[model samples]
Target chain A: MPSQAFAPPAFADVLAAAARIAPHAHATPVLRMRSLDALAGCALHFKAEHLQRGGAFKFRGACNAVWSLDPEQAAPGVVTHSSGNHGAALALAAATRGIACHVVVPENAVAAKLAAITAYGATLHRCEANLAAREAACAAVGQRTGATLVHPYADARVIAGQGTAALELLNAGIGLDALVVPVGGGGLGAGTAIAIAGVSPSTRLFLAEPAGAADTAASLARGARVTDIVPETVCDGLRATLGAPNFDILRAAGAEAITVDDAGTLAAMRLLWQRGKQLVEPSSATALAAVLQQRERFAGLRVGIVISGGNVDPHALYEAGALHGARA
Target chain B: MPSQAFAPPAFADVLAAAARIAPHAHATPVLRMRSLDALAGCALHFKAEHLQRGGAFKFRGACNAVWSLDPEQAAPGVVTHSSGNHGAALALAAATRGIACHVVVPENAVAAKLAAITAYGATLHRCEANLAAREAACAAVGQRTGATLVHPYADARVIAGQGTAALELLNAGIGLDALVVPVGGGGLGAGTAIAIAGVSPSTRLFLAEPAGAADTAASLARGARVTDIVPETVCDGLRATLGAPNFDILRAAGAEAITVDDAGTLAAMRLLWQRGKQLVEPSSATALAAVLQQRERFAGLRVGIVISGGNVDPHALYEAGALHGARA
Candidate 1:
């Protein structure tokens, strides 16, 4: 079994990654203020990661993780468990590095995402619905094939690489008074806060959570990490509970989180699409929804929002619109 | 009347435009070879102009024309004859420069595009649906406002600026064997062919047109330009026939043009949205449709296609699906 622990990425390590990935990763243009901001009463600078390769920011972490492995350790390939963007990103990144990849996927996972992983030449391992089953399968696969395990968020390299997104934004000469991001397992937010804190001390960090499944907010309020709530938000990317290490990082950074309902998220998504003409996913729309719903707090401040990805299936989009129509 | 007859764009003028608009426009990402290519048996590289500001590549010409005016000729503001992407783009760009703008629009243009122009602080002049009536209304508005007339395509600077898109693609460190672009007024094709020929002399140029309104094809076949086609293509942007000057430029460039039905455009659009994960307008999809439908001609070599815009209304999309469902 090629199960080896990875080292935690320091703030310095993330800065190093900002330099390393600068060429490969898109600076992803920041959209200027428009009518939506006037409605929300905030000066918004949207970092369009939805335009990122593989249709999401996950490609950053996935690419770094694959490229970081030593030749000997990587020879047998890598394994992880994900049902969405992360799976496709890792598969594509592995293909780029000419290494084998194994994705442990839940059966009901989106067909398009699965097609992307397969198209990138990765092997798939189907698992049961339970978390225990997914983890067990990943471990067994890693052991049987001597492939190294790359825990999506729990791994330090992935977190550090994800932080480079924020690093790129700040380095783009933006002096944001507040930074808002969608929080799922807290990898992106935790790493972003660390990056922002190190480079721009004046900036405040915020995490956006879906009200239907706000594990991060509950965890923040309880002064401890929380988990295992039934999440019903349409923002599928942010359904995971905060990872322990990420929670600690967020606590240490003194970041606060805001939650918005499904209605609010979809409305924000529609507004951004219509006014800004930028297509993004529900998870990416969460921060804008938070800002819109809770406007007074963000007024008169330069705010940065991360648009995480745009890989929603066309059918899923029709279904989402059906949900929106029902709400209307 | 502010309709001072502007010189039509010449092949050399487009070459110079390749230099002028280089810094202002995006090289627009190009994606190549995947599942769709496997099915079509030819490589496809999509130049995603839909990612351009104002949600369309029309911004490039509008920006250059608005900005290129001798600070004095540009002072009273600019007038255009569009109720679509060009109207919005010119409005936004003119607003950015702190200049006034006048848009003479047909009463029935898309509301979203209308809102965009109004949002950018451009003065709108509603006109009748009849072409002669619209042109007369545009002239009246331009004359009354003392604004410089910035025709959508017929003008030399506009055509040259539109050509800049293909120029950047050729400059982006890749050597493609052929270039495919959606043809409307033949502005983009005329400009793009000139640009491509100036750089890669061997690269063949082809134009894609919707069969419902294949005015450019009819005009080319008859060895002259014709504008009196009862346009019916769902690709609204492709409704314009080849302008007189544009047809002249195309004839000189030795370019070939083909027309595809709406079904082919939709299939290509779906392929791009699903497999390429890029959102674009139907006119943009026509280029890929040409490649997909005529796979035998482009087998085994590299090809580049431009996706022109991404501003489809959500309601229209729902309506399209509804109409298809009812028919089925």
Candidate 2:
């Protein structure tokens, strides 16, 4: 399918995605931490996607995409280019359908993530640490195996599937004033925007982005796609440039952006682990960081923060002394 | 209350305790980890006491003990000697009833645990690392402040309160062939024994103890309480000698012991964090370690493992290189 042919996922797609992925995906719990709420000066409802299958929200989209494929389309299997969580999620999703999975992983990917992708029985193709190289490697694998390519966050099905998390949250009747989600390729943010618009129109959407990889923020600021910067951040999951359709959807939904530095993200991650007892990765922490960084804006509001994933290397984080300080 | 006059907590007490604590304590979720089940070759139901208020199963007992107090008794507040979790739990529980709480903490307790105790508005009294010093300090505090002593595990109210966790697990309707819990002061284990006896008589009970602090196992083997050995394990929460009443209750229940070394506990802790997405402390990991260590005994059986706590210092664990390698 060509990029031009792709349509932006609507709230209806999210509803369908919820029903389609119900059998395979986990309806992760919404956790409330009083300590966290006290710190943020808001009632925070945390959608614990870190506890989802494959230890991330990536599973929802991966499972939806894999199962949505017809028998003939799925016969050749599925392929994707991912630095970590999506690769493992897609591999696990493909495994559920007993189909082959090919993942093009960048050279600089975390070792623990590579181990997980392999553990999930994906055929990994190593590529240079660049989008061009990753895409080329993925295309070559697709050509060879006739596998259908599942773009990490750009695809409509993936965006719709990612929205199910927000749908579930809204369905819980938490009456949130605003929702915050970390934006990488913007699947979760765009999907969440659509879900909030349909189910709770009064709810506002805030996209959390790492300052080092703040293309989404830049895009939102300039009212256009921004894909030129070289990403630099500890959040391995939030390094991708905002995808075109994702940008369009987010812009259309009037989503706001909250950018957090690496220091803020690390501190928030530590707080989540220590106080919340939830082992969310740095990418997941960005959502909390955003809420905390802008406390004045979120004060006394019922805010929802989506913990995007928990596929981190504790050893690596420890080695970096990321867990040493009490900043947040 | 004199030791000679005190009776072991019975099923009736457990029922009463549950009712008393229902308003204060969380009925923690029963989580299922399929990967963990596959690894252990059994259906594993994880009683997530780590997510309990004050980050441990200790809250149930602490809350019950505080609420069970008469208004005049509660007015003077409560006091306890604890290395970690119980202190924080008691402090938090006391805070709920707007009562003063004094915690006698050993010098060598984890810094994070100390922070949690202080965070919960408890007055901390530091003592030497010995059990005798801790008790002396606790008694002195009680004498000076007119506070009621809430023993970590020895008191009937506490034991009954601890039983509520297992009661909730049993109430979840997940029929299990066996249940596992880390044996520290044995409050949780003793309580669990009563719960199992009352709710599911056929369910076997297994106490997961640290080999370096295997007094519970020693007491069971010798058919008497043994409080002589110096504990030398990394599991901060499981270093206590078995309480006398706890021993008596376990002996009556014919509970089995499964001791795990520090290395096994560390490995299992890492696995729980990495795969189970639960950042459990070493004490909590012992239950999973026990299951993994004695796989054959639990194979094909529906097993319940109570994750005791999550008050670990990630910085300390990392500095000690506890999260370095994979051995499980």
Candidate 3:
């Protein structure tokens, strides 16, 4: 098993991560929408992580993880297995530190995402399109280069980095009665829960999940981690199985999991594009979708929602009819 | 003839408008794109007016015109002839003032724009799809309801309001070597010129025009306003005839005009979407297009470009191939 020596990230870790990554990561704006507020019967504050550098909040975690590495450890470079924002983010962070990065990308990765990763100057090792092949390829690379492997959502530094987004929100002085964030491997959700628990203890934490890949919700319902379920969702970013430490921290923080179907997520994404005037990804829309679908729970409350990412293929989004509310 | 009684807008007028609309108008952020800068061989600072209220900088002028009127005059409400951003801007501005707004729209106006205008609570008066019909309808509405007419881009108050955008840029302390703005009726162009002349005289101003609607460029070449040329560009916002006072001010300020073909404009728009991650309209893209098309003029210089608006139909933008830079 991977190292379980590091304790779960804490409020102080998030604070230090914020200071460490402040020069690199953007403090993305918190957007407010009046029409959406009226529609949802709540004052919605959107943390525009989609506008973050590398087009996603992954940059924050990646930057923190890269910076947290010792100079000797960083010199060997870093390796990861991702066909998504984390690869690009890590590549960019490595570039900033003038270190080499190897991304073991599956062959079936989205062309756009691959382009982005390559554009950031990461060396790509194409592997078969499966978790087993990807992990094996990543391990081989790590062994050859003596490069540290920054597990996308399982690393303590990465989790601390992701929590800074919520730290900014809570410090912005907005009274958020609750906070909603999409849960994939639980990095962002766990980070947010820790931030809220530390700074704004009264703010309830809610995790949004795609119904097609609703393992997190199921895990919470069964009171045990669910790992056998196969993922099936348009939210390609949120398909990872929940990390053990992340799940433990989130559960301890009393975070609740809420599932939103793909249709609902797509509809919320369209609303974000049309009314909120933000170009957010479907994975980012799940948080708003959960709040919208469970309107009564958020009614008359001021809630903060995290927009996960903006890196999306426009043609695919349009063809899927997510640009409009039409069924695909 | 349209009234020529009021003096042309001045720097003080822009300042006043800025203060008057400060309570309502969003101080849109100025965005920087490193990749785009590397591509264009210049430092580009984009004023994100697309994120402004009503999805465009038109709201600045609309709010200024609506709020500048005497309490009695404002009570009778405001009327305008527009099938675009100006109509929605005026409607929303009027609504903020708790007054009625009547928009004389052409029948062939984009349905999305019309819906936005209506969503802002404007009473739409549809007329034939011609300039004369729209003007006549607007005049009739103004005459019947005793409402003040807020010309979209020609009025002194409107010009002053639009100038506030440039004023904000100049005041932001970013040392811009030049300013570029898309020219339609020349309100934004003239306002930018006035702002540059008043605050940053060393900063040269350039006007971007689509080659299909290259009357502004032809006018500068001929030393006369070319009113007879019909527009055929995809930049719907920049199709209006140049206003007399606007042309005079722009000329006196020594502003130069550059024409970019629709293909170039669309290419720049796509680059902006993919690299800059902004949902800007074709009109806004023209400024960047001009910079890219006329590389020598702005080479190695810091330039501020106005992103005019984001109100657009996704399908239309896509089918036109502006999203992919392929031929329609």
lDDT tens per residue, model 1, A1-328: 5655655678897877666666566667676645666798878888878867777888888877787788998899989999888888888888878899999998787776788889789999999977899999999999899888877787787788889888878877868999999999887897798788778978999999999889999998999988878888888898887988888888888899998998889888777666565557788889999898888899988899988887665456665563354211
lDDT scores of the candidates, listed in order: 0.80, 0.89, 0.88
Candidate 3 on A1-328: residue-level lDDT in tens? 1223668888999999999999888888888777788989999999989878898999999999999988988898899999998999999999989999999999888777888899999999999999899989998999888878888998898899999999999889998999999999999998898899889999999999999999888888887899988999999999999988888888788899999999999889877876665777789999999999999999999999999998877788777666664321
By DockQ, the best candidate is: 2
DockQ of candidates 1 onward, in order?
0.19, 0.47, 0.30
Q: Please, what are the lDDT tens digits per residue for candidate 3 over residues B1-328?
A: 1233768988889889999999999898888777789999999999989888888999999999999988988888999999888999999999999999999998887787788889899999999998889889988998889889999988999999999999999989989999999999988888888888889999999999988888888888888899998899999999998888898898898899999999899889877776676667889999999999988878999999999988766677777676774221
lDDT of 2 by residue, B35-69 (tens): 88899999999999988988899999999999988
Per-residue alpha-carbon lDDT of candidate 1 for residues B65-170, written as tens digits (9 for 90 to 100) = 8778878778889988887888888897797678999998888877767888898899989888777887888788777777888878787777888887887777
**Considering lDDT, which of the candidate structures 1 and 2 is the better prediction for this target?**
2
Q: Write the per-residue lDDT of candidate 2 for residues A15-115, one digit (tens) a residue.
A: 99999999888889888887889999999999999989999999999998898898988999999999678999999999999999999988887776788
Provide all candidates' interface root-mean-square deviations. 6.5, 3.6, 5.1
lDDT, residue B278, model 1: 57
TM-score between candidate 2 chain A and the true chain A: 0.97
- Candidate 3 CAPRI level: acceptable
Model 3 DockQ vs. reference: 0.30
